[model samples]
Target: MKMKKKNKGGLLFLMSVVLGGFLGGFVGMFKAGAESNGIILDVKILIPWISAICLLIGFISILLTFNFLKKSRKFHSLYQEEMDDDLNEIYYVQMYRNLEFGTIAFNITTVAILLALFISVSEVVILNRSNLTLSLSFLGLVLIFNVQKYFYKTIAIVRQFDLAFFSTPKDVLEYINSYDEGERQANLEQSFRILFQLNQYVLPVLYIFLFIISFLTGEIQLLAFLLVGAIHIYINVMQLPMVKRYFK
Candidate 1:
């Protein structure tokens, strides 16, 4: 009886699953928000709260998932396998290099946007620069780029791992956490199933809210924004499977 080793497959599977669904669901939420539900508050505090809540949840979910994976079959092997430390480090570093770059870029851009937005909100800026459209567009770009970056990285991780597997079966048993190609595909199918179910429920309700809010507020511009946001969400959701399968 032998213990399994930590395979890159399981890590890749989970990353694809959670991140795929997370991205879809998050976009769905934005779509829902864009539908004019007539949500109103102190702009000063409201904007900050919106930003804070998302950033908090992103960090928290990552942390919680890290702990859960540590307990699940997804964890690295109890018995370590021998490897060159430098090689191991290099492998991980190369895989994660873009992820690091993306994060830093996202942070710098977001901070700049926020500062510009904050300045625009005050009388100090007479340029009328901040608007609903600009804010939403930036958010939309962030969502697209963030998801794109992760999927690109995920594919690279999978390919590199597959190549590594050509050398040894250690990755087959312990590295992948199981000896089933079915498991890899299962991760993807499960994520889409959840996403489709979620979108089916979310989109209609979001639209209804939009219709009602525009009527109540007498702001037809809100309707335009809602339409744009919902379209973006739909495009992302509908095309995501194709994008996911491209790596195959």
Candidate 2:
């Protein structure tokens, strides 16, 4: 068992290294292409295709997200209806799992929407000044409302779990005792830790890519990337004091 675990860990590390190298090479190739050929695409044609793809995917994600929210509500209702200890325990577990899955699904969909928004705005900027119009960017703006609606629905569904959502310190303590105790809370914290670690590792590469692309294109609007990258770094730095305090 120990050998198998070690082998699995090593395999994962190897795969990550290979994937990172491939991505780095791809970025380098793009940079080379840009430098040599002054790489440019016809945004008049490209923007429409990208906008269509984004809208189609965003619509599908929104539909699936609402479906997940409906399932969560169903699970919450079933959990409330159960009476026997064993049966209620089953329902409780199902409900908890549903909430966890729904939260992850919601986040994934939100990221897709945000990416669509980013690409839409980026493409708008890429368009020639004389040819620019909101008609090309309408889908992205539509997705902003979708994101807002999804955010509200996600919060509403989570709050349907009566034991969760707290308005006061006492309520928070009660919530911790009732819903977030033991392994569940630990898992939630561990997920955030993993995300933070991932951001730390990936953000530098992302910043470098942004710089490379901007240098190749001479587009100052890529300053957006710098602003976002700085905010990410600041957030990470802000968390360090708490991390030190925790260890101390």
Candidate 3:
């Protein structure tokens, strides 16, 4: 089961990278073609498409949030039962380490893609007075915020589990007991829900704000932002099921 999960994660990572690359390349080609034809595209052309995609993302996030709530209830019940059973400390420690590694890998890939996009788009931005450069740069900053958040959270989890792994079994059990309490568990669930919920709302708002800036400034490189936004949404949404599975 663990191996299967690991393989599934690898596949997901591969698919995300491929999809991102394809979208980036497709936009680059379109821009090149447009320039060759002596026709400059307006950012306004992208507003409807971006808005539609954002709406779709918002709808999906709402559904996922509802599903997550149901899963959380099931998870809490399962967690309580597990706490009463003969728990495998080694299994949990390994799980945290795996999660940490996966997070690091994800962050690395995301940063790589962001850098590539910036490099590819910078030349076009510099040549044109459009706000595409500024919009993408701002989006990059938002992506950085998300990457840092995930990294910090995973690091904390890894550290906690690392300590648990080295401690005596009795100490590990004590720590688990403290962590698995009703209040602590509820807080954990709430925190997870809030983090995703914040991303769901905050990201669309930020993107819309950027869209306005791009539209007004006439520097609309909507394709890049759309691609990045899609990837971001995809990653976050994809994690919901994994989060549910983790608790299971």
Candidate 4:
């Protein structure tokens, strides 16, 4: 049974890698063809729309995040007051799942904002010298600052967890992993497993993205994609020995 499970898992991993690579190659080819055929988007028009959408999404995500945090804390307090109340504990877990989703949404928006800024600046520097890029760049910076403000507010709400604005990432991860055992711990582990799977599946696609951009832009230094791919594979390879030691 264990052997079968291992083989199944390996097969799934292989499938995911194959799928990711296929999609990545497809998109890269499409992008390259589009550029060659002069089917390009107008940056000045597209950027403002993207920025506005991100701003709206970011605001909604922040509000939902705060609401989830507040409900989770309330349930946590109730659970503490009546330590035997399983309902309170379940509610706490539910609220936290919502909070996690909200956090992911907010983080994705922030990344989008950063990407917008990078593109806007690159346009000004390389393609077109326009006031639109300058204005969009300023807007991106402001959105990023807003992201920081809400992010700090979130930390304040969860201050009981010993998280802070400037806390080292390792420290924050350690604190998170120190959650009370049982459902919360299981949920955290599940989240970690999902993230690991995503990394395995997405890293190849991301490398393809970088390679495509490099090819399009004539930037050979983007071979840093090789470095990224190496580190990702190395981490997975090293994990086998670590897992072996843990099992032993």
Cα-based TM-score, every candidate: 0.36, 0.59, 0.28, 0.58
Compared with the true structure, all predictions reach lDDT values of: 0.48, 0.63, 0.53, 0.63
Ranked candidates, highest lDDT first: 4, 2, 3, 1
Q: Please provide, for model 3 over 135-210, each residue's C-alpha lDDT reduced to its tens digit, 9 standing for 90 to 100.
A: 5444544555554454444434433433332358677455455554664686578768876766765665567556
**lDDT by residue for model 4 (1-248), tens:** 99999999999889978987887788778777978898763435565556556545545654565566556556545655665667866765665665566567667666665655666566567756554545655665675566556655554444355455567968877766666667467877897886686576567667766766665555654457778878787767867975899999
**Tens-digit per-residue lDDT, 1-248, candidate 1:** 12233456567678867875776676566556756575542235444445444444444433343333233211122112327676555544443443334434445444544543453344224543344534543454455454434433443343333324133655534534432486557656876886775566556546555654454444554755677577658856778777889966
Best by TM-score: 2
TM-score of candidate 3 against the unseen true structure: 0.28
TM accuracy, model 2: 0.59
- Candidate 1 error regions (>4 Å): 1-45, 65-74, 79-179, 221-248
Best by lDDT: 4
Better of 1 and 4 by lDDT: 4
- In candidate 4, how many Å is residue 133 off? 6.7
| Candidate 2 lDDT, 1-248, residue by residue in tens | 99999999899889978986887788778777866896663335566566557556656766666676666667677777877888878766776666556566556655665655666666657654222223433554575466446544554555532433224767645544555456457877996887676676666556766765565455754666967677777877878987999999
In candidate 2, list every pair of residues with a backbone clash.
none
* Stronger candidate by TM-score (1 vs 3): 1
